[model samples]
Target: MTKLTSLTIAEARAKLRAKEFSALELTDAYISSIEKSRTLNAYVVETPELARARARASDAKLAKGEGGALEGIPLGIKDLFATKGVHTQACSHILDKFQPTYESTVTANLFDAGAVMLGKLNMDEFAMGSSNETSYYGPVANPWRRKNSNATLVPGGSSGGSAAAVAAHICAGATATDTGGSIRQPAALTGTVGIKPTYGRCSRWGIVAFASSLDQAGPIARDVRDAAIMLKAMASVDPKDTTSVDRPVPDYEAVLGKSIKGLRVGIPKEYRPEGLSSEIDALWNRGAQWLKEQGAEIVEISLPHTKYALPAYYIVAPAEASSNLARYDGVRYGLRVPGDDLIDTYERTRAAGFGREVQRRVLIGTYVLSAGYYDAYYVKAQKVRTLIKRDFDEAWNKVDVVLTPATPSAAFAPGEITDPVEMYLNDVFTVTVNMAGLPGIAVPAGFSEQGLPLGLQLIGKPFDEETLFQTAFAIEQAAGKFTAPQWW
Candidate 1:
């Protein structure tokens, strides 16, 4: 029998339905694996009992012929999603003791589909860092490393834990959010398939806000098919979230293994900038070549305004974050610090609660949105953002899907980037898709010389995840699933 850790969601569901393995047994296997792989630091909180209870319920449902596609499969929830009766801190001190009274729409939807919840996973504080180091719980270690080397590698953030847990077989798949590369970057680092569906594809109502305009919920799994299953279950239109699209959700799994012949894949010249690594450049070329072998028409195109994407994203995301985080005033929902006066209470609480990076972003955000500087910073950045979206609009006119490197380079060591601006630049290749509210995905293409994973991103037309997944599935089949790190 294949261990629970190695089986895909579809395989597990079939076996489970046939009474080959109980949901409790599967959950136990993953819990045991998590215990054995302590060094990965993937989870911030483990809810084994809760998971077992949910699994038992699923098993009962299965007995009654009431099971869904994901029924009884263990799934990891990124700490960013609000879970009712569970602590959701966003891996930050500011909301340390915060427990939500209501479940996030995403989490509720997963449960509604019969997926068992394993636990809340770790992440960079407030989804701000490139590496997982900025997390209050400490950095998550990459499972891959050279023999006899004590060097700690990065599990990319802020969805690092989600990717790490799935890669380590702690869960069959995980729910992840990408506000400027959180899901895709970590998926690349941990060598898993992750997708950021079109902006409104998944409801964001219960997810903890980071960059509201850019944040999107998706899935990270071992294969494209598993990702599709989990994504379909999680996607629903919620009236609570104004941004959630009310359009009909597609059957993502139904179209898997479909042919990609005659599809137009655009290769943006501007993505291969001067400073990108030769190894990455080579892998990108190899990926494009592989698509050609599969009969995809690769055409070179220009997204000329791409150069301004990073700067504009920084301005827009932080501005939104500052406004979102202002609700944590130590009064209503989160931590509370007693003070001498009303103003003192707010100042002292925020200063003492938030991490340095979070504080830095808050300050920058406040400054940009301030009365005197709004026109010069915020307004100008929005215009640039519009131009960046226009660039994509022009490209999509001629192509069905756009292909590019997910990150400038593979995962770096923990704490490699001390400068905040440099850290922000890590999302250069990713943030634009979020800005345009388009769908994107990161699938493992190959590995670097040091054996770290490299990923290729596919940006699709608005709400056109079918094309994105088809393109990604083709690439994933060509690349082959990566072997798990031995240390895991």
Candidate 2:
């Protein structure tokens, strides 16, 4: 018999339907596993009672010979999502213990489909950092370690907790937001599959805004199939969110294992930047080869503006962050520090609440949006953003999908890269997808010389996630699943 904790969402779902195990029993197994894996610091809150209750309800539904898509499947919700009375802090001290009365659109959709909530997962404070160290809760330890070294490495961020939890088998899947490479990079580090749907594919309402234009909800799971199933349940048109797309959500699972014969997968020429590691280059080239072996054609295309994506992303994302974070002033909710005056109260509250990375980005955001510099920085970045989008649009005519390395390198030790600029470069291959509002999926391609995981990303046209999933399934079949050794 397989340990329930080791089962993928799809496996667990099938087993649940076959009466192989009760939902309560499965939930209990996960709860026990989570309790024992505390050193990873993956979850910010563990809602065992609520999870059990949901599982019980799912059991009853199953007994009646009917249930939702994810009946009894337990999932970890990111702290960035508003879970209506559960902790929704974005892992920032500023929103300390901030509970919402409403649930995020994505989470609500999952719950409505009978998915059990394990609890809120941790993340970088206000989604500002590349490493998980910026989280108020502390960094999430990657379950995977270098072969013989005992050093702990960061499970990337800002969706570190989601990625770590999924990789460690703490949850069947997890809800994560990606503003830039938050979703893909973390999944790459933790040996999990993560997908960031097209910008409006998943609603942003009540997800704790962080660069509203770039923030999109998706799922991190043990494998490509589980990710596909989770994304199907998480995506829906929401009346509350104006940005939510109105198209019917396709059954992503149905497209899996589909033939990729004759598919043109674009290998962007500009993605092979100067600083990319040789190991990563080999993994990416191997990924293209894997696809080619699956009867797909690999075409080296050029998205010339790719070099400008990182700089433009930094300016644009922080500019939006500055505007979005303004509402957190010591006014209605969250931390409030009493001061001599109103402005003092705001200053004191923010200074004590936000982490250094968050503060730094806020300052950068403010500076770009400030007088005299707004046109020079923010406005120019937006123009560059348009050009980046155009670059992708034109490439779509030449290719069915694009393949790139998810991160410049594999996971590194926490705090290993002291310079923030060096850390920002980690998104070199990923930021362009967000800038173009296209869907992208990161699947583990291979491992590094040190035995850490390396991932290859598949970027698809906007709202064309089905193609991406099909292609990812092809790669997943070739490379096979990469699971972290159970050192925890």
Candidate 3:
């Protein structure tokens, strides 16, 4: 018999509907896999009982042929999402043991589709780090390691645990968010598929905010087809979230295997920065050639404002984070440290609750939003953001979609990057999509010399994720699937 935990969501869904195995059996396989893979620290909490109950309920629905699209699929929810009566702390000390009374719109959508919860996954505290080291729960080790080396690598972040869990086969898929490069970067590092849909494509009402304007929920999955399937079930408009778009969610999976003949694929010159890894550059070239062979018209384009995207993203995201996080004062539901007085209590509580990375970002956000610096930093960054968007708007006139290397290099060992600025550069290739409020997907395309996975990113026009899914399928088909050696 095939290892139940090794099946992709698409395979599992079909087999589940065919009654080859009950949902309870599938859920048990994952629960057992997760228990044995704890060395990766992918899951901060495991809800086996909850998952079993949901799975049994799904089996009942399936027996009557009345279940939803995700009918029996088990998924990991990023800690940043609110799961009612479950741990939803965003992996931060500040939000210690906090469980929301309400469910995030994305997770609710998944559950409504009959997906089972596998518990909250770890992440960078407040979704504030390029690597997962900033999480109060500690870093998630990437399932992929270097060739012939046992040193553990980071799975990228702030969606590290989501990516790790999927790559490790502990979940069929995972709900992840992208503020800058949270979802894509981690997916790239871990040899999984992730998409950061266009801003406002999904509701954010129950998600713990990092940078409200930049954060968007999507899915991390074993492959592009699985990602499309999960995203369809995850996206929906909600009255509770004013930012949620009123547009209809399309069937993304339907577009897979579609031909891309004459489709204009843009290659941005600015993306080929100096000192790019040779292996990554070679794979990127091969990706274009693969698309071109399939009749995609490769066009060289320029997004001049992309050079400023990283700095602008840092400024804009942190500024929003500081304002959004202000509500976490000691008086609220989270952790509180009593002090001499109310003000002292607020100060002490924050000082104690926030992790170092969160504190640094909050301070940076506060400083940039301060009266004297707001105009210089925040306003200027906003202007740069507009230019970045304009750059994409211009590119759309000449191309159907844009392609770039997902990361500068492959996954690195934790603690290899110490300088904050150096760490920020990990997102240089991905932050522009968030700045432009566009949809982007990362597909595993190749491997590094060290034998770690590498990925390519596809950026699409707003609300044109169908094109992204179709094109990513092309890449996936050509490059073939990558699987980490099962060391856990």
Per-prediction TM-score, please? Answer: 0.98, 0.99, 0.99
Error of 1 at 180 (Å): 0.6
Query: How close is each model in CA RMSD to the real structure?
Result: 1.2, 0.8, 0.7
Worst 10 residues of 3 by lDDT: 325-334
Please give, for residues 279-316, the per-residue lDDT of candidate 1 as tens digits: 98998998898888888899999999998988888888
Worst 10 residues of 2 by lDDT: 268-277
> What are the per-residue Cα lDDT tens digits for candidate 3 across 66-142?
89999999999999999999999999888887989998899999999999999899999999998899999999999
Q: How far is 163's C-alpha from truth in model 1 (Å)?
A: 0.9
For candidate 2, write residues 398-468 as lDDT tens digits: 99999999998889998799898899998888899999899999999899999999999999998999998
Q: Regarding TM-score, does 1 or 3 come out ahead?
A: 3
Candidate 1, backbone clash total: 1
As for TM-score, the candidate ahead, 1 or 2, is 2
RMSD of candidate 1 to true structure, Å: 1.2
Off by over 4 Å in 1: 146-148
Descending-lDDT candidate ranking: 3, 2, 1
